[model samples]
Target: MRTLRMILLAGMAASALTAPSAGAAEVTALDLGAATAARLAMGHVRFANGHDYNATVGFGSGAFHRPGDPPGTLYAVTDRGPNIDCAEIGAVVGMSAEALCAGDTAAKVFPFPAFTPTIYTLSIGDAGVEIVDALPIKTRSGRPITGLPNPLTLTDTEGAFDADGRPLTPDASGLDVEAVARAADGSFWVAEEYGPSIVHIADDGRVLVRYVPQGLEKDLAAADYTVKGTLPAILAKRKLNRGIESLGLSADGRTLYAALQSPLVNPDTAAYKTSRAVRLLKIDAATGEALNEYVYPEDEAASFTADAKAGKVKQSDVKISELVVVGQDKLVVLERISKTTKFHLVELGAGASDLLGSPWDDPKTSPSLEATPDLAAKGVIPLSKTLMLTAEGGPFPEKIESIALLDESTLVVISDNDFAITGDQTKVVRIALDKPWN
Candidate 1:
């Protein structure tokens, strides 16, 4: 198979590779070329762990398309800023790990605490990818919002600190956005992991309405935008940092579907670590009301062919990163571990059990929905899933959090690169599938 590669070199020219046979698949990395508008200048930071932080704009957090946009145009959003755990900072700051973070192990230090989440318009072609425009997400007052963690009142929260080991106040408007979907009316819906919430933004990037789980409204009361407690309350059980990561919008933009990144802690953390039961929500786009919910059984680590080959044997490592709607009640879900990614076509219309108001939604249930191993034996039917593609090794990189259909037979994927904190460059890859998804 012919594989194309591109490295970001100043004034480097891009070349196309020969296409594979009709029945064979191909993967090619788009040459981002030189660092221009897409690159963020956060200066340099010497971490206590002997690692220097290199600033780069995280363009892969989420991606979407405007219905009437150019064929190769896509809009992408960035996540929060560069952050490291206190344990990582304690080592370099000459302080004990426990003492430096005020005994909160979940505490993190943001080197660039003011980095704002922004969206970019990209154009893809044979020459590579080009950044056409950018829009920084803003509040009602027109001020950009940071990516800092929110101080949740009803749900779990983490502490935020600065480079000097000083505590940083949490921002109610802070959002760790993971996915984006555009509506027919020009507004955008973004999935956030911090509130595990969904935010609606006007065409100009101004926050319109923010939706969160029940009882979590008070926490974001200080936010500049309107807040609604419209999601299921069980979502508060989402594992810290692993909330709603994937989102999909129906063709007509009347419905929205959100997928949890992992199983909920339901009863406790032990259940979350070993459970394969992830939740998917179908919401009313116009009202933010959760219409129904479905179980999305994430595969075990051993099932991911690439991870097995690499000997990474933890089922908890699997996560749903992105979703693409193909047809009515039909969508493609992106699941991945660090080194491997898989796409599965999921059907939610027939034969799937809706657990909306069932015992599974109740936190008091004895065997939390997540703790149940044999969901089928329990008469609980999950959404039907068929593996569409397995992307392993080469061309593909770690933390590929965004994907879009470039055409009926091809897909474009982007890696998060964690803002290049570890010296990894963000890569955009195009994959030609063996068969057309249409």
Candidate 2:
């Protein structure tokens, strides 16, 4: 089978998350669909010119590296486009999105309702990786922008198709963008698991405003560009496609940090399976309001279980993909669970605990900021974390969902190869920051 999957990706590219005890951390990776090729897409089922959209260019879902780049250049992003595996057309086990392909309604919720949503740019260093540019995401008179969804009961009212199964028309400027943050005048602000919105593009990729969350603002006002509901309202209780992955900005960009990739079906879903409180935002990036809020606990999907009694962990697995800002109010978060991935270091100081309009965003508080029990004995408190890096080896790659810190001793890391059709491989890895750069 392709030489046992290239010997299990060369033993997970020698992982153990690249030991760093004093070994001065170092890890490399590279592999990004051999740096693109053409024959893009059209009606692919698996291949034919309609496939190889270069493994759908999953673009690490969100990354950045500017500030006098040219070093190892970085800038990835891509999500909500080119989806697959609604059980490959049968879609039954634990339905999601278009209710897992709703009886194959021609694979709704996008098989590629015209993909678009891109941003690549890579380049990396130490002699490998390439791609140098890709851009797509538009609409400021430019158009494009797909990744279909939004335009119904508000958010993931999912539904779109057309590979002959017909019915295709979602995309109220669809955006499931997931984490990205860049703005020292270059603009860019991503963060959108559909309607968890937070957009703000400009600097060339168009889109100028989208905020979403308070009552879905007339379901994104007939969007095609520019929408703004302005968040909070208990984040409208998220959890459709798990809202707002992770987006950050402060360091004078005037605050803005999101992060809530799970644990909200709020008052139910059995309090979202024993809630590990998740809801972190500190906005005001020029008025989306919500100035502070905390409580961001997760990881305890039996604490990152890669495998337990062969039952392969569950509890909705866990997420909260990436958050960067590194210190001025701090944050470095990451945290994943499909096998393993970690990185902590939070610190929102001023003694944490804001939880916004508190009472733990009621859904009948009781024990529900994800089962509170004693958040510093109810004075709340949560924003404290430390760990930093934890993917301890064994051929990992189901999704490391992009992260970048590129200098101050490099850290890059990327993944979300669902485009690799689950052979899941979009390696970028780079690790090497043990210390002395903080």
lDDT of 1 by residue, 156-188 (tens): 888987665578898999989898887878788
lDDT of each: 0.81, 0.68
- Write down the RMSD of candidate 2 (Cα, Å): 20.5
TM-score for candidate 2? 0.32
Best by TM-score: 1
Question: Candidates' TM-scores?
Answer: 0.91, 0.32
Look at candidate 2 and tell me the lDDT of residue 294. 87
Q: Residue 281 CA error for candidate 1 (Å)?
A: 1.1
lDDT (tens digit, per residue) of candidate 2 on 1-438: 011111232335543443222222456565444335332223344322233323445677778765566668877787876665444543322234344344654344354577777776778765556787667778767888887777757434655654334567766777878767777887778887867768888878889888887778786677777777777767767777788888877767888888878877766677776677788888998878787888887767767755443366766677888877766778778888765777787888567888777777766776677666466887777777766566644444556877877676677777777565433556666766657324
Against the correct fold, how does model 1 do in TM-score?
0.91
